[model samples]
Target: MSLENELKSLIIAELKLVDIKAEDINDDQPLFGEGLGLDSLDAVELVVLLQRHYKIETKDLEQSKEVFASVRSLANYIRAQQDRK
Candidate 1:
């Protein structure tokens, strides 16, 4: 499976977002107010998930918003950070 698919699966499984599926998450969807409707706590969970799954660390609040934009964005960021390491 693709990284985005894996990411979507992880996010759903880890975050327990019952209603949304991988395909429901658009590549450029906003994960906050107007899109997936995730809150700040969910964002924290995303950060923890990324660190645990991808072994990349990030703590910047604003940067987290961009990185957690969507599954595709998170996957791409993980791939890029992994490559840099």
Candidate 2:
């Protein structure tokens, strides 16, 4: 599957999101607020998820904000980080 798909699945599973499937996630949809309804704690879990799954360490809070913007954004960030290695 595409990285975005993978990340979507990861997000759903990690967060134990009920009534949602990976396909339900829109690539450009916000993961917080009105989109996925994730909160600050969810953001922290997402950062840890990235590190655990992709070896990506988002140490900067502001940077995390951008990186976690959406599935597409997170997928792009992960791909870019992997490319740098």
Candidate 3:
């Protein structure tokens, strides 16, 4: 599966997001606020999800904002991090 799809699945599963599926998410959809209804706690969970699954560490607050923007962005960040290795 594609990384975006994978991330969507992980996000739903890891975050325990009920009534949602990978196909239900849009690539460009916002992950927080009105889009996916995620809050700050979910953001922390996302950080742990990325680290546990992708071995990624998002320490910068500003960078985390961009990285956690959407599934597509998260996938891109993971790819970029992997490419660096």
Query: How would you encode candidate 1's per-residue C-alpha lDDT over 1-85 as one tens digit per residue?
Result: 9888888788788889997888888777777888888898888888899888878999777887678887777878898998898
Shift in Å, residue 55, candidate 1: 0.6
Q: Candidate 1: misplaced stretches above 4 Å? A: none
| Candidate lDDT values, in order | 0.83, 0.93, 0.94
| lDDT comparing candidate 3 with the true structure | 0.94
Query: How many Å off is the CA of 61 in candidate 2?
Result: 1.6
lDDT-sorted candidate list, best first: 3, 2, 1
- Tens digits of per-residue lDDT for model 2 on 1-85? 9999999999999999999999989999999999999998899899899889999999887888898999999999999999999
Q: How many clashes (backbone N, Cα, C below 3 Å) per candidate? A: 0, 0, 0
**TM-score attained by model 3:** 0.97
Q: Cα miss at 27, model 3 (Å)?
A: 0.6
Quote the positional error of residue 62 for candidate 3 in Å.
Answer: 0.6
Off by over 4 Å in 2: none
- Lowest summed lDDT across 10 adjacent residues in model 3 is found at 6-15
Name the 10 consecutive residues with the lowest summed lDDT in model 2: 58-67
Using Cα atoms with residue i matched to residue i, what is each candidate's TM-score against the true structure?
Answer: 0.88, 0.97, 0.97
Clashing pairs for predicted structure model 2, backbone only? none
Assess the local accuracy of residue 50 in candidate 1 as a C-alpha lDDT between 0 and 100. 80
